[model samples]
Target: MREISLDRLRTLVAIADCGSFADAARALHLAPPTISLHIADLEERFGAPLLSRKRGQVRPSAVGETLVKYARRLLAEAEQALQDVKRQVEGKGGRVRLGASTGAIANLLPRALELLALHHPGIDLQIAVLTSQETLARLKSGALDVGLVALPQQATDGLTIKRWRRDPVMAFMPAGWKCPARVTPQWLAVRPLILNDSSTRFSRLTAEWFASGGQHPVPRIQLNFTDAIRSLVAAGYGAALLPQEAVAPVQDPRIAMRPLRPALWRELGIAHSAEDIDRPTQHVLDALWSLRLR
Candidate 1:
């Protein structure tokens, strides 16, 4: 017996479905001769005619009807198998390790992760809360797959960085404090400040903002975490310059958020190891890109 051919079976089913050899060739993008050859080869192999043809019309012979039924199921299964392979290879079902700062984890990552879970449930998303410096170090050592960090990380050879978003730095003060729609650095300098710790980029930027105005204000309290700083500001302890992400979520009635005069902004970015931007990491990036964050 001649070996069975899926191509011939598919072509036979196509001819039966379309009701003519010429139509089958058009549908399958095959030359008419190629379609004729496929039917002939199948008939020769099975030792039975597969088509019943008359002027201006075509139908499958009894034998062709049986073959076509099996062909449809077989082709569908084959398509499904191919899709399964592609999904696995593209990291749709794999684990993605992600790192980001506390502010990102609290304000930004939750929404992105929720979207990822809704669409790609098979991907295991593992997240770690780390400082920008810690995230970069972990990325270099292959301990992390991807990171959301402040822009301009240490120049290194093995990392690919892309700008993600810029969060405006807003000034947070106690309620009933008189301030303009946009507070100036000179105005901020006179208020008792509660700043992010010196290790954080926010601290450096806030310091630079004041120095540019030929002023500097010592903090009444210095802390690394945004929520704690917000707590102090809400309790009437001091004012703070915090990213909009950190200030937007506070529910305390004592807190008021205002833009900076020059509109200071903190740039966030995505970084991955140049050597290991595998499929799962890219899926996470794709999910993040789908979000429109302010």
Candidate 2:
């Protein structure tokens, strides 16, 4: 029997994640036939079917489920091996893959990246905009060098997390709306709301805060992006609860912001794999720390 190739394992994992050959091919930038052939080859070597296709949907067989679990682990290790070799030769000049939540990217990370660019010109930076959960998953899988995430209440194992900054959540109201000096949960609940989509950590945090007060603020518009939420608020659609940094870029005169009473705040932080900190990762961390101090 032939040994399974790294390429085949990678394809299997992608297929398992993406749920179909066409989708997996798109994700891996390979043709559908290529992905099918790779999976077929792997099954041939193992002498067991890896996937079951029924009614145009693909499900992993029992053997496929077991293989996928091991395949993901092997692929993660292989990627780490390449990163390790690159780090040895490149030192601080290697590429750093960083991920950030939308709120952090609006202000915090751009400033840190500018500082990193000035100090380490040789280090190439690749930035990904992702939700907090996605950022954590990428960091754990060795897919990201470092991540800027909203600090969770409980820390995950095998990760080093440092508090970067605290950003207050504010209510954005229309220009003529009469808002108190300090808005309360009761006041916010009465206003027409334009809320962040339920998927984001920010949305969950906001929801929990309101729920704590026994109020459910119904949103007329549910937005996924921070900018879109700002636009809706500015257009007089409804008020929104967002991080202070997220609304910094908007200069619309139609919207006014008021601080919430008891001051809800979100903590942003830098997180990286505890076991895999390399020169490039350290360099970026140093830059971020310097920015924090400034």
Candidate 3:
């Protein structure tokens, strides 16, 4: 005998649930004859009667009762599988894995992610904080769907990068220091600077900006976390250069920011794989586009 088909089992279970073949056919959107044929096929496979009828109503036999339980579970599993596929296709209820630089995370990226949660409740998001180089590497390897990276000066071959926002690089200094309205690279070089180590792209960009102006201020402190940087700045450890948005959430009375003259800026962008833009990736890109910074 041929293996029992899931479709035949489904028809049997549906008829049992509806208590009639005609009703089951209607519920399944199948013709009544087709429904009958499915049940007949099931009986043939089992070599025994599966369903009984009396008073124009259909009921399951003893063996059919046991099969009914298994059939229900099988149908449920099949339906769930389809729903999972649909969720992925619709981008409504799947996981979106993303990576971003620490600077972007300190900026308004959290707000954008919050907006996505509010608007698209079904999508699950996983975000990782990585440097721009790490983010680019993971994106290239298909480890991430979307990446928030500092705009690279050079061209990237296999990725699509678009500017999400431009933020001024500002000097976070101690309040009451009476600095200029806009700090120049020359003016900044005179003060002790708390520089993030030159391992990150942002740090390299900052280092180059100072180097081009023939300024190499001695570093008083070296740290990575933005909040820690702000805290150290507020405590008057040393002045630090950071993106404006990174300082937006700071309300410390002791900390003040002065925009750099010649207006040094960091261009933050969203990068994605060029070959296949998955639904989840597109969903995140759409959210990023709607951000106030963008």
Evaluate all candidate structures by whole-model CA lDDT and list the values in order.
Answer: 0.84, 0.83, 0.83
lDDT of 3 at 220: 86
Error of 2 at 125 (Å): 1.6
> Weakest 10 consecutive residues, lDDT, candidate 1?
243-252
lDDT of 1 by residue, 189-278 (tens): 988999888888768888988888888888888887777887889889999987886424546788888888777888888888877466
**Positional deviation of residue 103's Cα in model 1 after best superposition, in angstroms:** 1.4
List, residue by residue over 45-157, the lDDT tens digit for candidate 3. 78788999989999999989988999999989989989988988987778888898766777567777787888777878888988888888898898988888888645678
Q: Pairing residues by index, what is the TM-score of model 1? A: 0.65
lDDT of 3 at 186: 87
Query: Which residue pairs clash within candidate 1?
Result: none
lDDT of 1: 0.84
- Clashes by residue pair, model 3: none
Measured over all alpha carbons after superposition, the RMSD of each candidate to the real structure, in angstroms, is 10.8, 15.5, 4.2
User: Can you write out model 2's per-residue Cα lDDT over 102-153, one digit (the tens) per residue?
Assistant: 6677667777778877877768889998887888899889899888887664
Model 2 CA lDDT for position 180: 91
Instruction: Give stretches of model 2 more than 4 Å off.
Output: 1-92, 246-251
